[model samples]
Target chain A: MPFTAPPLFPGDLFEGAARLAASAEGRLSAVSEAPARAAVLDALWEEAAALGWPAVMVPEAQEGAGGTLEDLVAILDGAGRAALPLPLAAACGVVPAMLPAEAGGVVLPFVASGEWRVAPAFAELMRDPRSPAAAAATEGGVLRLSGSVIGMEAPPGATHTLLHAPVDGASGLILLPLDEGGPGLRRFERLDGRPSLDVLLDGVTLPGTALLARGEAVARAAASARALGTLLVMVEAVAAMGALVGQTIEYLSTRVQFGETLSRFQVLRHGTVDLYTRHEAARALVVSLVTAAAETSVAELDARTLHLAKLHVGRAAREVAEGAIQLHGGMGLTDELPASRLTKRLLCVEFDYGDGAVHAALAA
Target chain B: MDAAGTDYAAFRAEVREFCLTRCPADIRALVARGGKLGRDAWSRWQRILFDHGWGAPNWPREYGGTGWDLRQRHIFDETLAESDCPPQYHHGLRHLGPVLIEYGTEEQKRRFLPGILDGSVWWCQGYSEPGAGSDLASLKTRAVREGDKYVVDGQKTWTSHAQEADMMYTLVRTSQEAKKQQGITLLLIPLDSPGISIRPIRTIDNWQHVNEVFLDGVRVPAENRVGEEGQGWSYGKFLLHHERLAGANVAPLLRQLARTRRLIEEGATEGEEGRRRALEHRLLLAEAEITGVRALGHAALEATLRREPLGNTAAVIKLTSANLMQRLDEIALDATGHRLVSRFRPVDGNAPPEGMEWLQNYLYGRVRTIYGGSDEVQKNLLARTLFGH
Candidate 1:
């Protein structure tokens, strides 16, 4: 039988996100310094936590909405369109999906190589500067582990860390209490001024039940979930880029240059048209990927689809972001404007899950 | 509705069986090797098909054809495409046969239609010239009146199968004083006429299927003109529509994609994640593109079958079909890796199959977007027809 797109939800996810963003348009447009931005991030996290978006994908038996991966992707895309400061896609969408049903009240803080520093309080300190170290794992069921898991963002009021470690020739994910983890736990400041910490597990022990069983299965599930979450993030980024390009076109239409509106220039119009074409191709490919993933049960096939989607969408997002900034002129680069923030966010998204080149090579 | 009612299940089965029995083993091998069958081989195959009365399925019943409807035509085309049959000389069957049936004099029909069906005379097109390609109306090929005959003298470039063709269906300038598009006439000229020269233009990839024909004062009887003088434009336009319609078939491309998938699957290591992923992605994209072509082609065929006038959007279907073929070639070559680079030579008076066949396909596939009409021309036609630009 021929395939078809699934039934669309009643409300347009994008319009709802746009409405929410419009309510806070002033704050979103405001240029805030580092300290104020950190405060904003904190407030945004609380708001997101209140919304229970992080638990949306978890089963209903475990306090989640019992939503499908499609639902989480839609929510994350909405968040992206709103340009929300919270890492809801990672912390909520990916984290909950990775953890077991009963593993609640534990926030999974995402970390990358450049986001935090590794302290020498752990049993074995190894750093791969090339790869992102999002979470740490303990060797045993050592709740009070004697090792330092560094380069982690300490989401406010988190009780434990979902640590990933290689134990007994098998990689496992273990939950470790943060406060009671001895001198191994030390806080560090990130470039974005977010609160991150290094937990040093100095031979601390814990109950054997603390270890998350089926480490390999959990790791694979986490990777897949993260990939799905990243897909949503990439989609959201494309939507934002589309909106930005539209706004730039409107601005250029009225902005006079040499007694004529900038939009009156043929070159400008053609350039925007070219941008629109790229955006359309990327959007179409992404939608196809989403549809394929929703329909296909084949894991490797789905991964291939996702890889192609990511490669095309990532490249298009980068182009759109750069074009928006260039078209906006010198004011675009300023901290006082939202364009620079959007540009930074887009750059971060381009490399968030995987770079276009990496994904293209993978797809290839 | 019943499932069998919507599907041509029975017709498909019959065609498949017929192909297995009637399709010659030598021809099948030649097609499989990607080589063109020689004249004798083609004659044998055509006679076999004619014996079954399936030689000219697209022709009207009055003209020695079965006169099947659109669905049956589609089934026949699809079966032939999926089979190992050699490339049927399209100039006779696709181009000239339709033109003669549509606008030919009674004598012209009687003289040429049988040769087309019996594969007695191989035909080639003489449309393009050095100065007139995409803007084809500006052809300078002159055919001046000389009593009961017209002397033809001009050059036609990009003439397919001309080197082996027995006859040339040419558009000659019959009136220079008339408007640019007016006063041209279509004529059937013998390719072996004195002062006629056929020279192969080696393509970038060195395929010899295409050539350039120079008409140096070749004489042709006035009776050879298929239609009224100055009506060549209309006939040519009709011929183009037929060509585009036939070219829209996607079965060959679909078969190529299936072959490519098998090749990639067989070559890829089980644990080679990246290469396997890439192949899988390419396959999906190809499938999607093919589906799009099928959807568009079906719509167009339905419209034509209903005897409804197809608006200029026909160009859109043609453009998409050509693009799909080009993309299929690109993917096939990529999948084949360096096997595509190997040298090829024709054996036993038949074209080589593996390396040179693919190289030729790659090279000729580029012209799909250029010939019949350049892609840009199609797009412009679509723009005008759909958007009134």
Candidate 2:
């Protein structure tokens, strides 16, 4: 139920979402802190890729689901609701959500057969904000790529960086392969516990087939793709926090104190109420933004509304997690309970794409 | 931008035209401006809706209601709210009307349903006692059975609009031999009956709308009782179910959201610096609320279409809706500069005195989370329902 007034999308695209969610749930609980986190993530990815879930956002004329972003929103929501925190959105929408129909053919083989694991790197350029330093030069039909690709926070286990470069003064993407020694590449722990990479692409050559989009369309593609990636993480965070809120309330009800349940206390109950209210509200706004972004350009969507949703959700995730910890007393501080793990994720996800302060500043 | 299209769009237009033209200008102006909308205004608006056969859409068609589906009713509410028409006072129309249609005898239906629709009778609920708000089953209001009358005594507190209500559908202790819930029975008692006295309770805003209803040996006909004896508990829960579902409707709040936006646009500042901070908070709250309503509404509708019990989901809606109402009011306070009062006293400076209006609206909105089911009560219900308490 993506908060749009109309039906989210064709029903068939989501019929198996519940099944996917159940499998993820089973796999997640069975793994238990999952000594192999990246392996577990890949396992879930393989399961979804088996279902062509990755191609749902690709236009159908290109031999994909060719469905709208709304279809992917449902799958993400289901995964989120079940606490299945796989990067389904990145797989389904990140690269393809903003790609032109012509480029859909290029992305088709990678998506349909799971041949390439592409992750987008849409970070701020150090010197010039309008264009990245990753400039491409073409002479006599020979293409060369140089400059740095900063802030490519591609998660662990990704094979390629979906790089948006300035070629002939236009924003177009080239799917750059990550090779051995990772020339000019520095990878580190992301703020959200994932792996982030920064690369300096000094004089690299690529076939023209690597061009995802060209001309002014690249600007639209780049902007929408970045927005899509942010939207996915933000919406997923909302779902995860919502699950946490439910878990916290359930914990309070059963966790007895002073000869009664903790929920019996006015202060804690009111705290939960406040947390719950903000969570629902933030989720609603995010849904609207999803709807708007699908219909119009990402830049055309209401900026203030988008910022408000991000800021509220980020703040709410912290508030609910911290409050849940406080109410659980000793157990909350310990890793024995899921709250400890979830709270960390909630705290870290605030800085995933950007934090509340970033959103608030933009909103202002 | 077009919101709803095809049939829904056309229906929305029809409703907009009907509510805009038929609802009186004075009442619309009063509601749009925001206030306590005294008894006369409420009754007039309800009567206007009743005349158009649009009042009490939740009631069955046989009982003079429009028999609209839940979504249709929701759209109607949205349209009326967007038009700034006074809300159809819900005491009788939303709360008790459905209970009567479901549990009332033919005589009871004929006797009570007309007034609920036509505004000839104003009704107030009498369930909350001084000590039995969240734990309402512990109510102590007593009704002793006589040959054809029941001698009722005890006090009902927090009865909204009780001073103006022609009647009160009350819950009274019918049999002390059973459990707290089973011993209670609902009795429809006229407000003007002998031994019944209503004391007005002025809220924080200095408005006298709710009342402390005290009854001393008030005699009520046996025929006035709804359903069977010792069943008031069930009927009370049923009424609450109605109230909670109605609370889920985001229609009225949408009106306030639009009004807040209009106010912000009208008071455009050079930098919008300070104003942006204040308005952003309001928009955040409002957007969350609208989306929550949509999400919850969809969930609730799915449950209904599948013929499953709603089972305390309504409590979720009521809680969030109340918080949003209060949040919106707070924003209104900031937007109108009503929060800038000196010594905690609101001082009005402009004509139309919009700041005072915001103050009153804020004060009135304070009861949102309290009355429908206080924030505490809703949590308890949710805890019990979800955790099997």
Candidate 3:
């Protein structure tokens, strides 16, 4: 008998993604800089819109396309395979559920070591403690906004910032109009050439409704949401690792050293085996978690499962990513190659919610 | 599928009921205490199944077995595993019995098969020697032909249950000049024969399951050789195939996991959500993998019953099952915390609960993938079967 498993998803999601990934191969190869990358991201957004990705999670009654969690996983798996650079995971996972619909595609900045940073572009900035972007409270009917959020980014068509804050003695999400925010908002050019900004919210008066409730309920829900997004990031990292490893294996098969293909060397074969093993381990764990989330209804339990998946996948991702680079010789580190891009993205994903150390301590 | 078409369901229910009654209360208590049965208990348990004629369900009826089909065999294995019953002496039921049935003379079969069925003669395998383990075909245990006997000399290491065994079935080199695969012969040697000695090798887990058996001019009658002279290589290979099939038992793992789930549920507090969920997730994944293995095993057994070639797919089952066993033990240790560190005590009231079995199983499981042909060897077999040499 063939080694068959239960269908991971109900319908054509996996198949669709696989096709898209195959078709976009040339497009992905042509893209080099952030401007071209942003255009590719726009094209991806259009494709996602065509697939109704944004509406997959929304309830059918709430204008959603009536897709399940499995559907979302399939779509993300596809995105990973295609090496697409859209923030679909964050948008679908974090924004619609955690923040209000008006927030409009929030770039969820991750907080690590008391520093706030946006991923895919890890630019660090100092918090302006005097601005509404640093708002910590909303008393009575007035919104007492203070402090600044560093590492804010305004991509090509992004209209607003779905900023995160420690509000009223609790961490909450807020929608900040980037264009309306004063000189407090300073734009910084990133190494990856993406447009990022530092928003200062000093003594800004705002309506109570502007404050998204940072209650325990919201925090719990948001954390769970963030976990789902992190899971996709992990899936993407695995896919990229797969591609790089495949390419390296192909190169080694053709490249001769000492009168034989590099692949013929026992040492290289063993190293490749190690890489494959770690990659499979990560894939197994991630797929298992995705299946778990689909089959269960317990939110807290799902959150925990996602956390463990992140920890395992993060650690494996780093190893596989680095292994891919090492195997590719000096070409792996240069910007001219895709391996470096994968490495950078994987590094950012590793610290997105928490690193291996943070999650491991929590899990333990 | 109709209810009757699914014969496994009915067989599973029947085996479950049998285990609930025939499995000794003490054995259940031991399992409850996270202990596996010792040799003595296992013998009694085997006899219980023998009395019910359920012993050796995988063997043919002519050889004192149930003669069940593949699905039934799977049901029996699944039930046995889930019940946490004492492990039957596999050396007899899984290894020697099948080998003898296929290759033993009628007189040999009549004498040994019944004893194996009744648990009267405990069996141990003497395949691995001090000098030959992974390179098993290169065994140097010499068996020189005498007038009416073969003089066996050399040592066998890692002989399971050798201390308690009444007889041992061994592979010995019969001719030095013949190719490694050509000059070997299989001999059934009595453990109590003069010049045969056994010394226990205490492993890191402090268990006595393994032993080193030395044969200094031990002599066995000519009738003890199962097949033709210098044909032991083929017979040993056949025996290994059967052994691999028997080793792919996933039921015990399921039972252990069920126990782990209970322990986690009972011990962990409501606030320990992360640990609880992680354990639960692992349990589910294990269940899925075990189910997959069961399906694969059932398919292999069915092919065998139909007189079709199993090829090297048997190795696949063995490989997957060994991996699952290792994973289950790891999860068990993780679930029990420091309890795993304690030594194992006997199931009897006078002896403290022997917690050592879990540790022993963990250590033993590490060698499982390496033994019975390393996983790499199995994969190579698979690759050859798929792509050819």
Candidate 4:
């Protein structure tokens, strides 16, 4: 019997995004390898924006597509499938969902049009309240931010950042511009080839208008954004894990050892099956989370579901990465094949947002 | 009922109510003690369901089933498990009844469907033999044609509940063909046939759930064969799918985890703060595993209901569920430390010790990955689907 499954949630949309990603495989590889990748990233974002993906979760009243949660997941799944090294999750999900609807006049247009490559840096504020990255002081309608948020996604090509900081004894959401190059900003590549930033702020000044929301409003937005981001990145990881399974299966089918194909070996075959199971388990978790998210708005996203998905998807990603690497043997250790790159991507996913240990604590 | 038209909440409430009120207390007690239901207990419950017009939840209505949709069937199973109902008859209702309904002759269905529906007859599967298990197609149980009868000679091991069953639906080699699976035939044989002997095997679980059935030239009528002579492999595969779908039942795993949590709380000491936290951490991880398993199992069940070919779904579910079951069992055993010895020792009466049941359950769960299809076997089959041999 053929191995079949119900398509990823919102099947047709997922398939459309999958086809787009599949067609962009050549450009994606080029973008991954290019030292000066800003142009490629821009071009890719422009295409994705043209497709209206960034506007998916935005309301139609705000000149956005007003798509469902599954639509966003579909785009993320596509990005993950092709190992697209862009901040699609931030631009498409977190940033859009985090910016409050009432504050749309100030930021919704940029988000809806994809004119601003915004990376959300609320993880530190949500997880570590005392962290310096989330420290800020507001005085007389002026905000002074002092601290650095390290390794935020898409910082190399990002035009702005949506973050949360402490303001007058409460959390405040802020959008800071990143267009001008400065010594405080250092760009680096993550293990998975995505651009990460070590952003250091030495008492940077922003108008009071930069504060999107304060107190209860900011806290709720941060929670909703974190939930949305966690789920999108997880969807990507699971999709990438699926890609790794395909890569490993293809390798095993032809890689000969001891006068027979590796796929012919019982041990190797069993290893592949284990990889597939992990992928399925992770996929299932993502699907359930997506379904739940689809039924509720971003603010009402279930924390328990988000935490559970994070914990299991993180674990599954690592196991699958390890299993895929082992099955590839000598080829697994080198960068000659996609296995190594996909392995790194999965490991990166395992640590993103919060690792298994973090989510396990939260879930408990 | 259609999923769109049905109020599942109301449906769930209805099933839960029925199960709570209709399931006998004695049967529930037996199941709660981790005791296997005997013929009488199984028949009693089956008859109750039959009388209530729910003899076969998965079967078509024409075949004496309630014809519940996938969601309704899932709700029913979950409700039954929650209510501590004894496991419904599976070998006959799930495995063979479907096979017969799909491939059996009218006369055969007339002869078998009623017994399975009312639970008057018990059926045990005879797929795994002494020499053939994971590689079932290589099974060596031979049957020679003799006029209107086929003389069978084989030793089938891991025949679960063979001693309690009245009949065996078995696979036997009928001719020597190039492909091992091609020559096989499925036959329904009466356990009381002259030359059939069943010996119980005591497993590590300290239970008599499985047996060894030795057939010394036992004769089955030609009409007993299901489908065409050489089409048994397909039928057997069909039955195996049903067998694996049973792994999708996540209620028991969740129930076991809940029990483990209770045991953890019961063993807590005021001063053992660090130990309590550690156990709680492990319990949290176990809950996550069950959650993932339940999610994946539900997805796979939906795919099955759509009649879609589940590529590695069945195998994946079986393998994952098996792994999760063993993990939960270990945690339960750990929670009740000294009671682990109960698995190795004998119990005096029905009510032995508080944790004795956990020890036995943990021991029995060891077979989850071994029986049906071993973990290795499932992986190999899945690999075949992905990469052609």
Candidate 5:
């Protein structure tokens, strides 16, 4: 059975969330036991596609599931708890939040069915000092774009990337397809075993439809997408921390030394309590972000809440990850147990979008 | 200011208007300098609130409060802090008034609620004795039954503002036959009662912020006892929860952070480039912390508004807010740069440096992590809950 977190806020999404969580938990269990990355990722993607996971935030008029951000949060939270090595949040959350229904109809279907996968590069655009400086020109119903973005955590096997670029003195959202071994594209491995891409787009050509949005619409959509993406990353990290906290407590209760279980030791118990409190604090930040979102339309995102959630949840994830690993003693150091896997996922989540230093600078 | 589907924007504007226009100028200035608003000035502010029907934001309407929800209360407090308005006298209003409503008898409520609402009476908490701080259940204060009164004898230490208060809600040992927590009783003792003596305790800031009160054969009527005999422990626990949540007050920290920003801007012209950058970085982290604490406070408020148990979330807020307060104070002092070495005799004729205020605030903020269940104590409480069956 999947580990279900209590609903942080009351909503109609819980029913759909319960069903999706169970499906995700079942598939992730199988993925965790797989011996290799390539086949495991493909199977995970196919299973998610069959389950219609990526279309959760798309509008129903676009032949998609048509769910709210709350629904997407529940799905990504489940993915985080399972430590599913996929860009579920990026594909399902940021993409839908960023695209209008007309554009969503065309792009989401390919993404939902696993024919194409996409990861968000908004954080890179925000943090990388080297501006994408992307300029776009319309050429007889086609678009030419050129920009360079660094530190993008491109999901393994991702077929496309979504980012914002300046076009004609206005911000434009661009969706670019990836060509295997393409020039100006540098691929590497991330700390969490995911693929990282540095794309140097030089006069790349695409259909006019690739300019998903421009001007004020692009600004609002980008803000909404960034806010949604940050919160979703927090949801996933907090979910993983929740799982780690439970696992650590159980380990403490079961592990024995010096004639007593580790839980019975006051020092150990207090250390666990610190970790639990940090996890709860992060969870509270996520809840407040959700509440703030509910109070206003997602397009008019609350900047302070968004910034606070990113900075606070990022640090909390790091502390909980290190503390959970430390508390498990010898077993925590090994990949056989879920502790290390969960820790690695948490560390990856912490650095994925702006990280602590980047966010701290923004906040400062 | 929108909350619970209601737009609090109008309410916020009304509060801001009152704080900016109606609050007494001297009183606002007093609060701005971090000066204590003694009984008279506090009563003047309370009268203003009472006249405006904003006397008690958290109390029930039946008790003459504004009947505002948690969001309104937060807005009122935040707006007041932003405007440099004197904070409410929370001892009787926030701490004792709620306990009376929850567990007090009709008579006790009738006698105490009005005074607290109208700001006529000042009350200090008497739960801590010299020997019974964090491990409070082991208190040696005794209260033996004597006809129509309870003869109370105890030494309560750290009685904040006791000298300016009229009554103290104390915890006394009523029985020896049960667990340490089970044998205590909460009683309200008038400070003027016979055989009660108070002594001021000077601190690091050389300010008499707290006092030591000795209750020797002080007679408090039996009617003053809250709830049943041997039930004070539970009531005390409830009050402590309220105290811990209240201790996470975010308004003053926000004000301090703004002040730090001003200090940083003022220092930028004189400081070296690298030093200014370093201070700005620290200020950034502090700003992030203030934001986090404010969000946590909102979460706790939402939880309370929903009538949900705050549980360990309260502890988390208390711990983090306390840390943030001290951290902000340090940043403010550091922003003062070379003026940091102005240590001198209090009686000296030399005028204090510009950093004197920050120095005093830094000294005063030391109690944030040490009071209202210290950081270690909160950690232990959280641990017990996690480990409990």
Candidate 6:
């Protein structure tokens, strides 16, 4: 009856990640609050990298673990459950999946080794491939990139960015250093108090080696990255929402009014039940999306299903979080309760990538 | 596991074929057209399921039930619901049958069980009185012991299908000396008794599905009492649990959503903006349906493997499905931007106009949350059980 659901797609590696996240729960709260410094981020990344999470979706031959999609998903679920407060979502979801196998020999070790923290770009580009936000032109055999993605802001302690641009009349991936932004990178605060960046690759130069994959391969990697991103975030969402609702249920049971506990009120009980079902459904939908795709390579993951699942998970998370707030009444919005944190996290998740409305159109 | 899980794939295929092939075409047509079918048609459909021993998939097999576990029952229900099969009439089949199987005496079972199985006798509930509903322990419908018979004199309101029923399962106050709930006794009263009268109460949907039953000095032998005296409250709650099982998923909402999507695709909206709105709401309903399916899967696991009794789950489903069902209809109306026409006639046609149906469905679906267990009552019960206040 408690809100936690059985892990729908768990593996031995996922179990290890879940345990690691559990052990590091209190320690990672800072990652979500502020962008970790180079040393702090490195230490955090090394701890996770030591467990080989970054290499989960990469091939083992490329100095990676060659883990299944479920490994990445479970790790994200654990991180989100602990509210690890890091770019772990991007680290596990976008970075490894987006870096194509073709680029693994040159760049894979750094990425797989957690030496690079590549902030994702081209969220807007993915939606409108015809007019990508970033454009590229080659000069002296070096690619110069210029284009700005919406919803990007420079992080306080950023290193690398997985920038997507138009290369050779097709979408291509490039690893650009964040500090050399040339004034195109704008930084802003995300809902969860994390720093986000928007970058204009104007006059930004990438060596020919920075061209990871072009044509179908780049597009495929980008799509895979986005799909995996949604799925992993959803795993985190399920936990956060579950914890929030559980706290709400606990509050309703003890918080007394009318000489009776709120839990004794059928209205509140049924409302929590409603939230419970939503959490359960989101878990089932997301687990299916991740586990099924794990059977195939990341590039083959279905985007439409991922979009539909995200749409559902995002809405369900909001409902559970908001309903928890509403039922908690006065204590809901207060920082004393985790409901405050969950509400903020839910808002962030909803707007991340394409929201329900955007996914709806794409699904259509 | 999902619907595509290997364990249930074949079972789903079997149920799907049975529903598609065996369900009556007229009933299917009535359902697909968003119209009501005749009672005889409903009974005929039930008879087919009865013949297959699937009339009550959750019941034990020895008493004409299918003896399927939770997942199998879910597959059967989902298949039938999606096939546009007329919903099974539940007055005698789902509620009272389960109660009787669980608590009825051997002689009582012999007398009543077969009738329910054969789909012959129709029964209606007689729990809600003029004063007692959500707080049902306070019911005042009284019965006085007279030798070997109990003389009953009271009224039951919101008696669904009372006009068509041959018998009524009632809760009457037998003793008022101790507690409100402890003094209650359940009696199976014949609706055809000399002093019994049934009056129709039309709902907001202009449907006469529910009624008021007036009992004046109706006499029933002591044997007609279900189980022991002073246990009616317990039996009623059990019956309600059975009734609420249907709430687990709004699978039927999927059809309404599909129809709405088709309406949008067929140019139900006027402008580009309106079309976009229609598409957005349609997809929202789709997301809600996926959520419902996921909940259904988890509920099945809990009920089957964990042997968790259907307490919070039924209420959760009821509350959630009611809210979603209402939302689904609004989405349909949003697509068509239709108002209920004054002269809409759903009965005369194979398929009513989409706008009219959407409007009617929207209006009628308004009461789904209020009936069965009212949303408020369900919430209170779920709160108490889930958190143990």
Tens-place lDDT per residue, model 3, B271-328, is 3466567767887898788899877876777677678987766788788887887777
lDDT of 4 by residue, A139-216 (tens): 788887777775566623678888776766688778788866432665555556566665666668778888878778
Instruction: Sort every candidate by lDDT, greatest first.
Output: 4, 5, 2, 6, 3, 1
User: How far off is residue A36 in model 2, in Å?
Assistant: 76
Real contacts retained, model 1: 0.01
Instruction: Summarize candidate 1's per-residue lDDT along B1-389 as a digit string, tens digits.
Output: 13336457778788888888888787787776555455667777777777788778778898878766677778778787788675454578878898899989898999999988977778888987866766678888999989999999999987878888899999999998988889889999999999799987644334466677999999999999988988898998887667656655667777777766775676564334565666678778978978987877777777787788767546776787777777666555544422222212221233333344554565445666666666655665676766766
Q: Number of the top candidate by lDDT?
A: 4
Overall lDDT per candidate, in order of appearance: 0.61, 0.67, 0.63, 0.73, 0.71, 0.67
Candidate 6 structure quality by residue, lDDT tens digits, A101-175:
766576667767766656776635322212336777667878877655544422235577776667866878877
Question: How does the DockQ of candidate 2 come out?
Answer: 0.01
- Tens digit of lDDT per residue, candidate 5, span B36-95? 567778878888898888888878898888878767877888888899998774688888
User: Over the stretch B1-389, how does candidate 4's per-residue lDDT look in tens digits?
Assistant: 46469888899998788887888889988887666677888888998899999999878888887867777887788778877887675689988999999999999999999999999999999987754655677788889999999999988978888989999999999888648779999999999999999987644344577788999999999999999987899998887666667777888888777767877787765433544576688889978878888988888788887987767776787888788887877666545532223112221122333446675676566566666666666776788888997
Better TM-score candidate (3, 6): 3
DockQ of structure 1: 0.01
Q: Which window of 10 residues has the lowest lDDT sum in candidate 5 chain A?
A: A123-132
Which sections of candidate 5 miss by over 4 Å?
A: A1-364, B1-6, B241-249, B268-271, B306-308, B337-341, B348-355, B386-389
What's the distance in Å from true for residue B261, model 4? 0.9
Q: Quote the positional error of residue A156 for candidate 2 in Å.
A: 71
Candidate 6 Cα errors over 4 Å, as ranges: A1-364, B1-7, B241-245, B267-276, B285-293, B296-303, B308-311, B336-355, B385-388
lDDT of 1 at B284: 84
Off by over 4 Å in 1: A1-364, B1-8, B36-43, B87-89, B269-273, B342-356
* Model 2 C-alpha lDDT per residue in residues A102-137, reported as the tens digit of each score: 666776657656776766655332111223367776
The TM-score of candidate 4 is 0.52
Q: Can you give the TM-score per candidate against the true fold?
A: 0.51, 0.51, 0.51, 0.52, 0.51, 0.50
